[model samples]
Target: MNELNGYDIEDLEVGMTASFSKTITEADIILFAGASGDNNAIHINEDFARTTPFGGRIAHGFLTASTISAAIANRLPGPGTIYIAQEMRFVGPVRPGDTVTARVTVKQLTRERSRAVLLTICSVGDKVVVEGEATVRTTSRARREATV
Candidate 1:
């Protein structure tokens, strides 16, 4: 959505937050499984997954986390931001048809390095599915330059 404009490194402030929501789908799981080479049956085979504690096939954990990345790249810091590192903890499972919301809040910023540390989270309704921290190297004035 063009509603969000990328913020320069200097413009970011602690407590600034952004979010995006997506509905998990079977195709999403299948595509992510192929792209990530994670052929784990728990994510692809419902019959096999039904035997597990999760009760049915679950989406790849990284797929859920990628929603958080999408929020960062498209919403908060917006474009021209490069992911430096991320630490994630998968606390719950996401199933097809579930609506997941990804949120990122700026926790710290280093102006000299143009880096920001953010608290990232993904949830299905009130239950947290994933939580973590991400560090990004952001560009100052890159959005303006790209438009020109």
Candidate 2:
């Protein structure tokens, strides 16, 4: 890890991997709804959600997908990473009490290691709930040293 508690551009390798996990909770859903203004009934109302194909209340796709953010921001390229873009597909529902494990793998790196493409995946046990890709920029030790 670099002084920033993250990977410096030069520290990254194309196959590096890391993960983070969190269990969805009622409070998490409510808080997400309040914070994001995404109060869709399927995510916040059990009865309304039951009528949908999901069968019961489900966490917001973005809320559940937040695990992927956590994985990227706290692991792998870590703290100094700046996301450039992301693409995601929500394939399954995550309910309250489901533990979501998000994994990130380094897919590609620029020659200078200043940019990276990562594969992101989140699962509840064996069921994949989210799959995606992300591009990010990282701090460069050479650049930082040059400024000093």
Candidate 3:
């Protein structure tokens, strides 16, 4: 497994970006359904989903959104970053086998508060699957240890 290299709060700058990608799989959806208790037919029942507007079963929107969260937590300000708020819009459906890439870019930062605002987006190839903004409180190794 590969590990992400994260920056400290002080190192962040507007426009800095980080990303992570994964291929959506049947098992990924099934596990997300179970863990999130979002067993909607549109996500898990293929025969039923085929009758819907999307034409087939789609991955959970949150499951796709979580990819953005992963990128922020693991790649950007990284390990000590605490998510404070998020606003997301699901613009497209993610189906099994689709390769999704989650990307986050620094939009704003408050050095005094150790806070950052990031533009969050998830895409499958060239099509956007999800878009959002996320707010997080970042802590450095010293700050984290102090808090504990």
The TM-scores of all predictions, comma-separated, are 0.91, 0.96, 0.91
Clashes of each: 0, 0, 0
What would the per-residue lDDT of candidate 1 be over residues 83-139, giving only the tens digit for each residue? 999999999999998999999999999987889999999999999999999999887
TM-score quality measure for candidate 2: 0.96
State which candidate has the highest TM-score: 2
Give Cα-based local distance difference scores for all models.
0.90, 0.91, 0.89
Span of ten consecutive residues with least summed lDDT in model 2: 1-10
RMSD of 1: 2.9
lDDT of 3 by residue, 1-148 (tens): 0133357676888999999998999999999999999999999998999999999999999999988888988888787678999999999999999999999999999887888999999999999989999999986545656888
Model 2: per-residue lDDT, tens digit, 127-146?
Answer: 99999999999878898899
What lDDT is reached at residue 137 by model 1?
Answer: 87
Error of 2 at 79 (Å): 1.0
For candidate 2, list the clashing residue pairs, or say none.
none
* Residue 52, candidate 1: C-alpha displacement in angstroms: 0.3
Candidate 1 similarity to native, TM-score: 0.91
Q: Which scores better on lDDT, 1 or 2? A: 2
